[model samples]
Target: MLDVLVIGGGPAGSTAATLLARKGFSVRLLERDKFPRFQIGESLLPYNNDLFDRLGVSDELKRGEYFPKYGAHFVTGDGRTEFTFRFDRILPPEHQRSFQVRRSEFDHLLLRNAAASGVDVREETPVTSVRLENESCFVRVASGEEIEARFVIDGSGHASLLGSRTGKKSDIASLKKIAVFAHYRGVEKPKGRDAGNTTIVVIRDGWFWLIPVTGELMSVGLVVDRDHFVNCGLSAEELLERSIAATPFVAERMKSAGRVTQVYSRKDFSYRVRDLVGKRFALIGDAAGFLDPIFSTGVYMAMKSADIAADAVEARLRKGSMRGLERYERDMTRALGRYFHFISNFYRREFLEVFLQPSNRFGLLHAIVRILAGNVFGAAGDRLKLALFFVLVRIQKRRPVIARPIRWEALPRAASL
Candidate 1:
């Protein structure tokens, strides 16, 4: 019997399998799709650098053709409010830089690294069902194969294979959102060190993300409230075009660019599971929960949870008990909760006003920058920073300030190629 069975070949599964295999566990990882397949989440947070180093992929990532992202820039729809948060300002220099990658290449690299690390990785092997027994879990694949393992890990991302089977997944009502996106060529980019900075352009009903995936290619997407997007009576492509038109800075940047892929839409953007661990199994990555992509926390959360889950699994295997599972769940919940707390109020005008036109009162801007740099899961200092940030936000909310209203009418009309 395999010591561990990891479902899905994304960052979570690959990371878990790699770590466990490195520790001499008999691990098997199954993926429904072949490698080099297209995926959307291009921007990575700086914290991922540490995880990559632990996985021994930091040098490989550096050698890849991916764009180096140093920070993020935010601009409101009207282009009047804007601010930049360079990662170096708050995070240590070693953890201040990350990358914007083409998911196809990036994921493939990680999956391949798992195989190289002794993980028995099987591609195009869809897991049809998972059954937990008293002593082990049995996984059924489309090929009619049954694999028994001491423990099972669900890293199947949004598909939530085990999560759905056990009725654990629940949608986050407040975060009913849809994302429409595509890759583009020739999109205008900033010069110098800011060239790879991810640009977030906030509109009235949604926000746009512009990430540099490579020197000559960029990834552009809009995340909008589901109700507003559905009620717009526009196709996904149309909605994307309209969203681009609404964000002046994004419009100006893309004016001379052309899309290189078909527009894609993803719904039900936010959700959580009832629990991260259960009988002989645990969930990691999107299988456990997912948050809005405003801060580009998806991949970071996924890999971070995987790292924690691997530790728990190792402990369980050695002691024949799930001792560390509770800690894994607690740590992940606290990490995600910090993000949820801030993102829940991200769409509000007051938060945007404070964010885009930040005041350094109480060292609040630095606190906010630390969060943006994915430094929320660290020691006591990070917790204090987060608390200070929330206090500042509350103060900003109590003392409302009049800010410029977004001029929707001044936006350019939507156009096609």
Candidate 2:
């Protein structure tokens, strides 16, 4: 039997395969799609630098050409309220900045790096089902080939191959979100440090993301409530145009830009897979759970889960026991819970009121900066910092700190007109 079999060669699976092979475990990775395939989630978190270092792709990234994302700007579509959080302003993490990448390029680089580290990678091989019959683990592929391994990892991105087979995946009812996006060129973006900045253009019911995927191509997308989208009775392209036209912030930037790719609509699943850890299998990345993408936590959380799963898988290989598994679950749950809490409040006017108006009281704004920099999974001090920030949000609700709570008075009138 093989030591480990990783499903899906995305960030999570490839990361686990690379780390495990480096630890002397025989690893084989299967990817449903071939390399250089199109994928989304182009924006990355600041702390992904360390993960890149661990995967030994730091040199390739530093030397290679890619957009260096310094920080992110959250702005109202009208430009009345805005806040920018820079990674350099934070401490603790040595490398605080991240990169805006075309998913096709970044993912291909990671998978190829895994192969260089001795991971047996097979592309265009989709896992049909995973059967854990007693102690023997086997994965059935699309070609009717059965691959046997001592342990199996469900890193399948959106397919959730294992989660669907075992009926472990369930939807989160609260999050009914749809993302409509496409690529464009000739758009005039900010210069200097702001050149690589991702702008979150906040609208009344939804928001738009502006990311520079390359020196020339900009990835622009709108994320809105499902009801609001369906009620419009328009296609994804129409919705995107309507939204951009209504939002002055994105309208100004995209004025001279022209669409260069087909508009794609992604329904946010927000699905959770139960029993992430089992005797012979584990779900690492998107297969484990799907988080809201408002904070661009998908890549960071996926790689982090893979890093943790590698330790657990290594322990299981050495001790022949399911050790370190519980810790993986605990740490990921804690981190995801914190993010979910923060994301849940993001759509509310009360939370946005305080969050947009940055405050540095008692280092609280720095705490917000820390979370924005992807420091959610840290010491107890991290929790305390986030808690204090939420306290300020509540306090700001009752008594306005920087200004009165935004009534969006002019927005409704403009919409009606």
Winner by TM-score: 2
lDDT (CA) for every model shown? Answer: 0.86, 0.84
Q: Which lDDT tens digits does candidate 2 get at residues 31-122?
A: 98889999899988877788898788888876666788888899888878888888866655465678888999899999999999999999
Write one digit per residue (lDDT tens) for candidate 1, span 30-115: 99999989887999998888889999999988999988999999987677778999886667888789999999999999999999
Residue 215 error, candidate 1, Å:
0.7
Per-model TM-score versus the true fold:
0.95, 0.96
After superposition, the stretches of candidate 1 with alpha carbons farther than 4 Å from their true spots are: 401-417
Query: Could you tell me which 10 consecutive residues in candidate 2 have the lowest summed lDDT?
Result: 408-417
- In candidate 2, stretches whose alpha carbon ends up further than 4 angstroms from where it belongs are 401-403, 412-417
Return the TM-score for candidate 2, rounded to 2 decimals. Answer: 0.96
